[model samples]
Target: MTHTITGSAKLLARVRRIKGQAAALEGSLGEGTECMAVLQQIAAIRGAVNGLMLEVLEGHIREHLGPDASAAQRAEDTEAVVAALRSYLK
Candidate 1:
């Protein structure tokens, strides 16, 4: 029970960090930073966002959508994950 709360806290921390990174990237651009450096920061932030998404999706699959899940539940989880991946790729 407490673990769930702690896990959510950790996730929130990551999301906040990612938001900070995005803001920093914007600030760098507005500051007339070099194009290559700005692009690198953007790529780094995008990777971090993708990594966070992957972690959350994997956690869902392992904890809530395994053999213990009902057919309907598994199907829904699968669809959600697929949609997430599709959006990530696009």
Candidate 2:
């Protein structure tokens, strides 16, 4: 897909950043880092993952329903996406 091609670099960068965060978390644990610090790192990783999800969802919506789509269609699509994400992330 054009969205995938166009967004590959950005998405890969995010993935790499997430990997780095995971490595840091691992290293911190090895060094006996505090629990609070580890929790913060986990929270950052969750936020990054959510951001990636948003980007992919935006691309999916754009590709499937073009900008000229009706308002009701857009609303329905958005609701479905939100519901799916909420269910998945929980």
lDDT per residue, candidate 1, 19-72, as tens digits? Answer: 999999989988999999999999989888887887777777776687888999
lDDT of 2 by residue, 13-87 (tens): 999999999999999999999999999999999899888888888897897567876888878877887887889
Candidate 2 Cα RMSD (Å): 3.1
- Note the Cα lDDT for every prediction shown: 0.82, 0.87
Q: Flag regions of model 2 displaced more than 4 Å.
A: 67-87
- Winning model by TM-score: 1
Error of 1 at 76 (Å): 2.4
List RMSD in Å for every model shown: 2.5, 3.1
Q: What TM-score against the true fold does each predicted structure earn?
A: 0.83, 0.74
Cα deviation of 15, candidate 2, in Å? 0.5
Instruction: Give the 10-residue window scoring lowest on summed lDDT in candidate 1.
Output: 1-10
